[model samples]
Every structure is written in C-alpha cells, then in structure tokens.
Target: MKISELYVYPIKSLRPTKITEGKLTKLGFRYDRRFMLLKVIPGENENGSGPTLKNMHIPEYPEMGLFQTEIEEAKGESEGDTSRLIVTYNPPSSSDTKDNTESSDSEDSQARRLEIPLEPETATLKPFTVTMHSSPTTGYDMGSRYNDWFSACFGYPVVLAYLGTNTRSVLGTLAPAKRNNESWWRIWKQELVLPSNGHGNKMLNQWLVPFSLGYLVLNAVSWCHGRIENGTSSPAVAIGVTALALTVLWTVVNILVNRRHEARIGFADCAPFLVISQTSVDDVSGRLDGGVEVDLTKFRPNVVVEGAEVAFEEDFWAELAVGSNGNAGAGKDSKVKLLLTGNCVRCQSLNVDFSTGKMGTGEAGSVLKKLMKDRRVDRGARFSPVFGRYSFLGGEGIGERIRVGDEVVVLRKGEEYTVTGKSASEAWNVILTTGY
Candidate 1:
C-alpha cells in the first residue's frame, strides 16, 4: 500500500492545511508544532509549581511569534560541516548554524522581541520564558487536516478523516448490522434525529466486490433504469422512493466480512517518506526564533507518508507523536507509528477558534463529553483533525509533539510496536495495525 495523505498544524490551536508531499524526520514534520498555547489559568495544573517559565514557550506571550524557525541540525552534516541547533525569530538573532550559540542567539532574539509590547511575549523573555523553533519544511501542510475546520463549521476545531477505503468498511460493517438492530436509535434520542446518510452509502459500496467496479456498475444501473422509464416515469424517482420505503421496514443488513483494500502506490513517485532521527549531531537551536503566522487556508494535505504530515492537528494542540520510530523521538527504522487512531470527532462545545486561535469555554468540552458517552472517540481529552503538539488520544500525556527530521516507516498489523515519546512498552502501544 502507498501513503495517500499528509497533514500538519503550525499554531498550537489553529486550523490545519493539507499537503501533497513532505519531508520526514525523527522529531516529526519539519515545521509541525512549532508554537503552542499555554493556558496560564489551568484549572487543575495551574498551581503546580507555577510552571517555571524556563524551557517552555507560551502562546500567551505577545512577542514570541516575531521570528521564523528552522532545524539547522536536523540532518546531513559532515564531520566538518557546521550544523548547530538554531532559532532565528528576529532578524538580528539570525546566523549560520555553525556558530557557538546558547547565550548568543537568545540574547539576540530577546533584544528584537520588543515589537508586540501589549502581547504576552516580551523583550527579555525573563521569569523563565521559553521559546519554540522549527524547520521551514514543518509548515508545509499545517492547515487542511486540523481541528480548526470543525471549529468554523460547528464552532469547535473538530475534524476527522479516514482512508475513505478504511472508514467506509468500518462503518459499513458496523452500521449495517447495528442499524438493522435499530442501533441508530441508541446513539441519538430518536431515529428521526439522524442526519440522512448520503455519502455514507458511497462508503458501503466500497465493501462490495471490486469496489471501484461496483461503484461504476451502480452508476450504470441507475442510468439504464432512468433511460428505460423516461417520459413515462423516472426510475431515479422510483429507486429513491424504494430505498426510503425499504428503510422504513427492513433495515439493510451488513454481511460484508474481513473487507480489505490497498491504496495504489503509484500516486507517490517523487514523494517523501517518514524519516529516522538517528542522526544525533543536530542543529537543535535552528527553530526557536520565528514570528508571524500564516493563513493555513493556503495549504492542503492529500498525500501523506509514514505517519507525519503537515497541516494535521486537533484544536488546542501543536504536535502529536505516537511512537519512537522515524516520525518522532529517536529511531533508526524506516517505519512510523501513528499518534492517533481513527479520526477524532472533536467537542464543538470545546471548540477552539481557527483564525484567532482562541479556546472556547470549558462547558463546550463538557458538552462533548456528554455527546461521546457511547461513541468510540475519547470524551475527556481534546483532539484535532490534523496532527499536532498535545496528543489527546493518550489522555493529555498520551504523546508529545512531532517535528521535522524525525524518522518513521509504514505501519502494519499484528507486529510489535513502540509508541514514540512515551516509555510504555507493550503490544497494545501500537497505535493502529490494520486500518480497521
């Protein structure tokens, strides 16, 4: 099978973009999760040591987004090649990665950090202020697949995408049998409250023999029926009436079993793959000093490789790393572990703004929890449609953000897996084996 889509998110809680191809490294996407929002009033963890300002970048700060970010030491440096961890936020702090930094770059960024005085970011970045930096490739597709879409659609950044091939099968298998047993009634207060399943039928067709051919045949059949009944009666009308009438009586049963399909690998010819972060001599300081947020609406992620894609993230989050393979953390393997399972339907009640990146009230989150009482999605945790910083799947601490130059490989089923960024070791740590 070939990777068909990729996504990434730039801001901590903004919308996401879709991308066709991307560069992969151990930390994750090159530009993914570069900035994040730190809720200063955190209800539960607010009082915990007051979050010592060091080593952390808080979105609440105003002047933080003043510079650009990149990973100078991400990969490909020879013995004499100079590659240092570099962050160039303000112009003055900008320099070659070969320089001996640490105190130098910080001092420079701090000096030029005075533009947005009214904002949280400041000139000194004192009181333990932290900064974030990332590679340019990281910003590739930080829009299309993020939770911000849902926020605009429903006032919460909730988005979900499935290998149309995979989700359709899962829903078909689960829907037909369940619907036949009146399962829709269980999910909703009444069967009448359900939204009409239009495109949903498009999915069930995938479960049939020769899905592509079946869909073609279905279309052909609809055409012929209408042609024959033209002038006298519209067969399209007849079929539509029939389908509705049938639904009222016998609920269609789901008989498909062990459905399987693979995406054509030809789509990705000059594409990128999930990478390994084994190259230890890195330019860690290359990314921290970036400013200015782009309108993610410009990017789209349709072709993703391994597990890392730009413009993919949930609301209120930046990076998400599922395993320690080539996608996140450190790894020498060519494979990647997914930070999340199936697409997460977000809590609109927990909706976070897309353009402004403002988080909504806690009550919205509560509403989401109530709505998820029976669904497979996680209720207590937050999630984004695209990939990002805080991984909600692990319930807050599930996973950390993924960045560029991270390594990863294709995910397979029934194989031993190790999640990235976390210390847990077990077969279950495998995010998802089969698309099902």
Candidate 2:
C-alpha cells in the first residue's frame, strides 16, 4: 500500500491540517497534539493543586472539531527553523441563498483567526500542572491570549497548555501490580507525573504520589468526587478489571513476544501513529445510507494508504517499512520502519461530522453501529469495534521522515487464535502463546 494523504493535529480534538510531507518522531508526527485544551474545573483552586482541569475530548465537545490549525514554517535566512501555529475558527456563517457578495462580506461568514510561534526561543516557559485522559501532568501555559481565543470559540472557561515537560507511557503499557495495596491505589495517577528536579510544591507533593500496583486509581477519591458531583456517570467495576487484566497481558506479551523494541509515545491516543486505508472508508461508505458520505477525514487518521485488497486488512499487519515510491527495501538510509502496536477501537466521536459539527444519535447514520456489525474482532478489546491500527516508530527509523506516496510494506503478520480465559492470568498466557 502507498500513502495517499497525510495529516497533523497540532492540538488534540481540533481540526487536522493536511500536509504533503511530515517528519516522524517518537511522539508521532512533529507538532501533532503538542498543544491541547483543558477545561477548568469550576469552583476549584489551581494554586499548586495539581491543576484543576479536566481534559476535553472531541466527543464531549463536538464544536472543537470545527476549529482548524495550520503550521507556517519560518522562511528566509533570518527567520531560522521555528514554525508558527495558526488557528482558524469556523463560525455559523455561509451562503446558500441569493446576495452571495453580501454573504461573503458578512461577519458571520468571516473566520476568526490567530497565530502563535510554536517553539519560540525568546519566550519563557512557566511550569504548571495539567490533566489529560485523567492523567495529572505538568505543562507550560500558552499565556492568556491563546486561552481567550479558545474560550471564545467554545463559550467556556478553558486554558491552552503546551506539552512542555509532560511524559506518558501508553495506557495499559506498564505491568500491573501483582498485589493490591490501598497506598498504591491512592496515588495511581501519580505515574502520569513527569519526574522533576529538587524544587517542588507542597500541594503537589501532597497529591502526587508513586503508583506501582494493581489498577490505575487515577486521582482516586478526588477524581471520583469531581465526576460524581458534576453529574458524570460512575465507572463500572468491569472496566477497571478489564483494564488491569489487559495491562498485565500486554506487559507479558511485550517481554516474551516482542522484547527488542522500545515504545515511545505522546498524547496521540494509544500509539505514535494511526493508519487508515481508503478501501476501508469506501467499504464503510457503501454500507451507510446513500446520502451519508463516509470519508477518511471522519476517522482522523495520521497516515492514509491505498491499494488494500479488502477492508480491515491492516489488522493482521505486525510491522510496516515505509519508503519512497512504494519500495520499502529500496535503500538502507531511506527506510522508516513502524511496529503495529494494536487495533484502534471506535467510539461515538466518529459520529461527529467533520464539515459540520453536528453529531448523529442512536441508529440514525451512526458510524459506531455500522462498525460493530462486522469489525468487532480484536481479542483483547472485544467490547468496542476496531477500525485503524495503532503503531510506533521502530528501530533506527525513530527520527525518519515519511511523505505522501511513500510505500507501506508489511514486514510481519500476526497468528490467528481466539482468546479464551476467565481469569487475568489465564488471559495473559493465552495472549503470549497465541501471538495476538
């Protein structure tokens, strides 16, 4: 398969900016999700209190998907290598009636825009705590201007933070605790914190503690209290058990099955790269109603490839070596290898239309339901339907660059076996022996 398109989301949940070429790093594409929005939890003090912010995902606020961002790389000899991040807000202004000139000049039709230097050398980076995916971490606030722009777009109090020093291991990537300990549970979310120097905060030290056991008791009492008081649904016990089991299984599989590779990922979901196929989008479009057009954009994939024989063929691929002109083994210095980490599960976020921020409900043009009918085949993640594959840059290709039209050559294919087990230990053995 050859790459047909490329995309980078400088901020998570925001609209993607298409590019002809992109540099691949351990943290996915360069500039992808390097910045993010965090909704300020109301009525809370953030003074060293581990940042009173709840991360925003597209499903919770579909309007965020309407905001688009583009990168303007510095030009000329004096400008150096810095790139500016330009954001454009799409408002509810358009022209479907007569008087096209008037509609074009109308304020509603005009898009609000702003630009910020992505990696400014002259600016000072102030350290502040923030949360993402329920993981408490530190980031540098991008001043009040960027925060204000996002607040105006979302009509809510929010902040824009750069992932300056935040470090994260993939969810379920670490080995679970063999024994349950209340102390570990109390500080389960502490694993998300970035290691620091001697200087520290008393409030942060009081809250962030070491988590080395059992399940991820992310923020424990505080997290649950906030969610419950805010009228959010309490998590089921099954979800915790499943997550713990999967983490253990994944740890074992990594040790016994694939021990040589190192996994480095950032805030781009489960892995560093997500790949989708044009054939898969075509297949989904055919299944949906005639009026509903299912494009590759809805999936928000980083790399889009073409020439797959059938839909979901990417599931069996274990590794891919990317090279120019669809030739992975063309030369030694020009190849970038990627290891397929796991299958990406679908969620209600896919129901949100990219062009329009509206979302479909229930069975009415629901992409989730259509995917569940035939794509629920991931052994560990049987609860949700699988679509694209999550992967990581591997071997000497950690800093390599891949462009549109590059060939994606599969290196390994996984063995076929059904996961059968009632307990977590049994499931771990099944996963390692069967080679999922």
Candidate 3:
C-alpha cells in the first residue's frame, strides 16, 4: 500500500501540518530540534541557561509559537547570522482573520517561510545549541535514548506519514457518507487529543495538568471516498481510531454521521501541512506556554527515530545515508508488502540517551552543547539489543521499509526481496529487507 496521508506537529499540543517532504538528520531532522521549551526562571543569571528542569512537575508547554526564534550554524552567513530557522507565532483571535483572511494573503509566503500561526504562553531561545535525529533507515540504532529538543514543546520527534492518494481520495468520496456529532472541540478537549484539523495550526497556551500523553489519529484510509470520520467512525466519538482522527475524545456512544449532506472542505479552507518536529521523553519537554515550545535544559534521551508510511515506509535506514558520510548517491523506488496483524496505531516517537547507559533525569547536570557533542550514546554505547531498544527495522510496530518508484533491482533471501520507489537522489528515501 502506498502512503495515503502525512502529518507533522511543530508544537506538542497545537495543531499540525500535513507535509510532503522534510530534511532528515541525526538529531532527528534538520530543523527538528531547532527550538526548545522553557520554564520561568525565578530571577537567575541568564535564565540559568534557561528553565529549571530539576524534575519539575511541569509536563509541557501548550502554546509556544508566539515569540521569535532563529538558528545559525555560523551566525553570520545568512543575514549576518548563522544558518538557523527563526520561529514566531500570533495570538489567538475570535475574528475570521485567523481563518480566512490571513490564509488567503499568505499563499505566496509559505514558499519562503513556515508561517504556522499559533498562540503562545512563554518564550526563550538559544543560538546554536540545538541537536536532532530523524528517519528509519537500515543502520539507525533504535534503542539509543538521546535527549531531544524541538521547534516547539512536543512529546515525540514526528514526521508526516501520508498516503496522498488515500487521504485526497477519501475527501473525494466520503461525502453523502455518514458522520458522528460535529462537536469536535468538546470531544478533543476531553480526550486530550491534539488537533490536526487540516492545515496543522492548532496550538495550546495553558498547562495540561494531570496530563497524559495524547495523540491525533492518522489512519491509512482504504477508500477515501468510503472512509469518512463521522460516516463509519465517531458513533460515540470516543471509539478507537475514529474519534482519535477527528479529535473526538468523549466517552459517549459511537455515533455515525447520517449520509445525507456531503461536507466538503476546500483545499484553501483547510490545506494540510505537516509540522515535523522533535520531542523528548521528559514531561516538561512537551508542554506549551502562550505558543512557544521549549526544552527543560536538563532533559536528555538516548536514540531518536523518524518513521513514515508514504515515503520512508520500507527499508528506510538501509536506503538512507548521511549527506557527506558515504557514496551519497540517490536510490530507486521499490516496494515490499507485509501483513500488519495488530491494531493500527499511528502515534509513536522514539528518543533515548544511551550516551550515559542510563536515562538520566533532572537539570542537576547539563550538556551545554548539542546532543551530538555528548560522547556517551554517540560513541560509547554498544549496538546490542539492550542498548538498541529501538531498531530501524525488525521489531514491534516499526516494520521494514520498501522503495516504491522506479530505477531499481530486486534482492531476496528465502522469501524476502527488495523494492525501490525512485531513481533520483532528491526523492530516494530507504532500502528494505523482505521476510516472507
């Protein structure tokens, strides 16, 4: 099956975009951990490097997109500053401007900038101290836990997983389809689900107390025309994947939408964009304030992983190589099919710091530099099951990758074979090993 849809969350609890392409990096993705989280430092010298992450109960920042942000590799190359992504957000408004006006005027802006309008609660930043990780290629070790930071406060480092044909096709047919209640806000608020309403612009600005990890459902639609959220799912709203996708999280009975009127959403009304960003395991790593998302200066993980069904779905790690690390040649697209027997779960992010062999806590100790600067998980850790708690392939949930375009070969052993999707470097993603 090809990728039907893709999604990414720039901030933890806010809405996200349905993106098509992104940059993959060892810290996760290039701009993945660019921004970070912050707690109000009670009168300290230079924020004590910002945020007192000393095992504080503050789970995450709900709103972290209001302020400004930037990252510079040299601080002077671009605009006399290092090469880095600058972030900022707008406050919430009841007017239709946030919905209709701004969107109409910015169609040309998205080409040169990532203008995701969101609310914020606090703000703090660093010049070039961010680190990241991304992808599910062949050699990527899964169990290595490396503390991750991000563009916003998020629970995991995520990439958009999409099957364009499926997602777009569903919107085409599901009309005259059924649906549950349209009270999406109440449902999501109660379920603690994040909103992927369409254009990936939902942001949270308050505290998520008694907070539990929540996620939006990104399903692999079989027939976009037939699989409508309120049509087949949402009978009670709190059902399994149905409610999850539409942000319906109430404990009501499942309710299907009456197949009478076809509620069509125009590409302009709610275009999908993926907010691909990194996340750390610390409770404080995924919170929002006003709109800014920050890291608690003290948290760290071992390994980081990025997975996608549309592009990097098969033979991911195997098909991938760092920009300057190897032959640096593009790959061909191929496909390998496998049976996913378990229930479909769409929310998963991996981050660990095997750097010290122990997943350390608290800002009591700090790694002033980036995660790559740490020698523990990066070099000292062994590539064993105990350490690679997560692997690029051959494990639970994380199936193997298969190319799916053109220009390629077929390798096999026993009942296994390989597939490629493209022949160009710009699109080449991964390589996969088949089993059965």
Candidate 4:
C-alpha cells in the first residue's frame, strides 16, 4: 500500500490540517493534539479544590468540528520568530429565504480569527491541570485573550491549554512504582497491595486495612480454641476464611489489570498513530442506503493508505514500514516503522457532519448505527465499532520523516483473530514477551 494522505490536528476536536510531509515523534506527528479546549465551570471546583476544567470534545459539542485550523510558517530567520497556529470560525449562513438577503461579502465580515505562536513562551505561561479520560495532566494556560476569543465563539466560558513538555502515559504503560526515598510501609500499602476491580487503589485501601485486622482477630480466636476445646466451629473462624478468600481474589485481579508497555502519547486518545485505508471507507459508504460516500474527516485518521486488495484488511496488519521502496524484509532500516497496537474504537462523534456543523439527519448521521450491525468486531473493545488501527513508533525509525506517496511495507501480518481473543493473544505473544 502507498501513503495517500497525511494530516495533523494542531488543536484537539477541531478540523484537521492536511499536510504533504510530517516529522515523526514519540507522540505521533510533530504538531498533533498538543493543544486542547477545556470548559471553564464558573463558581465550581473539581473535587472542591482545584480549577474546574472539564474536557470538551466533538461528541458533546458537534459544532466544534466547524472550526478550521492552519499552520503559518515563520517568515524571518530569527530565533525569536516562531511559526503561528491560525484558527478561524465562520458562522453558518441562515437557511430561511428572508434571512438569506445578507450578501456574501457581509457574511465574510462576521467570521472570527485567532492566532497564537505555535511554540509559546512556556516560562511566562501559567501552569494548569486538566483531566482527560480520568487521567490528570499538566498544561500551560494561553492567557485570557485567547480564552475570551474561544469563549465568544462557543457562547460560553472555555479556555485553551497547551501541553508543554508534560507527558501522559498511554493506558497500561506505567512502570512499576519504585522506592525512591519513600517509606517501605507506604510503598507496600500503595503498590504491593491490590484493590478490587474498576476502583482506584487509594480509594479501596481503607477496606483492605480492615481485612488485615481480621487476620489478627482470627489468630487470637484460634489460640483460644486450641487452649480450651480445640474446636474448629466458631463465628470468628468463618469470617476469617471469607476475608482470606476475598484478599486472594483481589490480588489475582490486580495482576491481570496492571499489564504495562513502553509507549507514550500526547492529547491523542489511545495511541500515537491512527491508520485507516481508503478501501475500508469505500466499503462503509457502499453499505449505506444511497451509497453516499462519507468524508474521511468524520473518522479523523492521521494516515490514509490506498491499494488494499480487500476492505478491512488492516485488521490483520501487525507491523508496517514506510520508506522509498516497499520491502518487508528491509523495514528494519526503513525511514519509519510502526507497531500496530490495537483496533481504533468508534464513538458517537462519527455521526456529526462537518459540512453543516450539526448532527446528520439521514443515512450520513446513522453511520455508527449501520456499523454496529457487523463492525463490532474487536473483542477488546466489544461495545465500540472498530475502524482504524492504533499504532506507535517502533524499531529504529524514531525522528524520521514520512511523506505522502511513500511506499508502505507490511512487515508482519497477524492471524484472523479479534483483539482480546485467545488466538490474538497467542499471535501477539512475541511482542508482549519482548515488552515492545
């Protein structure tokens, strides 16, 4: 397959900016999802302490897709002059015939534009914290002027925060906690011990402590029973047995959930790279009622490839290399190599039509519903439909550049097994065993 298109989202949830070439980094493209919008809740604080900054996305606010973004290069050859990120918002024209009397020139005058340096002065910006997918990370506030401009566009209070040198690990990528000058007991309580499933370790620590107390009480009762009648039937004995069983179960569950990897990411959702094929999109369009071709923008894929013989063939791709010539064996020395991690899951945001900046009404808006019938294929993310593949930089291709029309070589192809399936686990055992 050949690389057909490349894009970068300077701001999350906004329209993507197409590019001819892009520099690959640990966090996908050079300027992808480094900035995001957060809703500022007035007279409220998160956890009754810090600033109330809630994440905003296209799913919650469909009109956010209406905003357009562009990157303007620096003109002068000076160290102080940096490239600027330009964002523009054009209000939709009125649909009523009476309200359509406004001239096109007059409507253009109503458009709003905002520009800020792509690389901001981090020393002068204020440090701010915001939560994405329940994980809190640090960012720099872009001041009140930029905040006011975004607030006016949305007709509500919101702020733009930039991820400046702050990193958020992908889920299941955290290294084991180390005892660096910390107390032994503290480490045991926080890291060594396990909590129940679907709950934070710290939040469930309180309950575990009581189980420790039960252990002591059981020891005392056993001693008394041996000294008196040597009987095993006692209320304390029953409670101790139950507590011991539960503690063992919790430990097993924690071990299964705490699997880790070595990948890192920015504001992008699950992985650094999202890859999709043009043939797969064409297949989805054909399934629709009128065979209306849907725009790829709705999927928001960073890389688009063509020449796939079959639709959805990306589901079996494990490793890919981009270079001047498409050769799987030579991918180790290629310009860029990618490790396909998992299937990219879908959400309700796919129903939004960017052309009108609103939720679709006909078959276009019901894309998610149609995919649900047959595309809910990934066992790992069973509830969501699988579209593109999530990937990360691997091999010796870091800091390399990839361009459109580059040759894409598939180094490895996985078996026909869904993610989280037994066969899939066996197929990926090599990568997992090597901790790639």
- State which candidate has the highest lDDT: 4
User: lDDT, candidate 2, residue 34?
Assistant: 82
Candidate 3, residue 411: how far the Cα is off, in Å: 11
Tens digit of per-residue lDDT, candidate 2, span 1-436: 7889999988888888899888877678888888878888766464655537766778777777678889887778755346788888875445774544554445643437878777644247667766434435567778787788788887888988787535564444311121112243233333334333234774565355323222344534445556556666445544454556667755764454332233434555556677888888888887777556675666879999898999878877767778866443423344477766566667767787655666765433488788888887867656667778766765456556788888777777777422212333232232221111
Models sorted by TM-score, best on top: 4, 2, 1, 3
**TM-scores of all models?**
0.25, 0.69, 0.23, 0.72
Task: Encode model 1's per-residue lDDT on 1-436: one tens digit a residue.
Answer: 2343455433322233344434443223433433332222323434566432211121222232332332333245451134322222332233555446546756754543321111122222322222212101111112233324322333323222111111111111111222124343332222212222233453344344344434655665575576657754467666665566545433322111111111111111111112111110011112112422222121112223233332221222212333333333432222233332222232231232232233334332132233333322222222311121111111112123333333333332212211122221111121121000
lDDT of each: 0.27, 0.65, 0.23, 0.72
Quick one: best TM-score, which candidate? 4
Report backbone clashes per prediction.
108, 2, 147, 0
For candidate 2, the per-residue lDDT at 52 reads 70
Give the local distance difference test score of model 2.
0.65
Q: In terms of TM-score, how similar is model 3 to the real structure?
A: 0.23
RMSD of 4: 13.8
Residue 246's lDDT within candidate 3 is 43
lDDT of 3 by residue, 343-430 (tens): 0001101111122212223331122212223212311121100111111111111122222221122122112212211221111110
Tens-place lDDT digits, model 4, residues 1-436: 8899998989988988899888788788888888999888776574787557777778777878779999876777852358888998866666673443666855554458888787888899999776555446799999998999899888899989999767775653211121013343444344434433235675455567647656755776566556446555465765566567667766764454342223567787656788999999999899878768788877888899888999999988878988853344335567477777676667777888776778887998998888888887877556667788878875345566788888888998878633644433332232221111
Alpha-carbon shift of residue 276 in model 1 (angstroms): 21
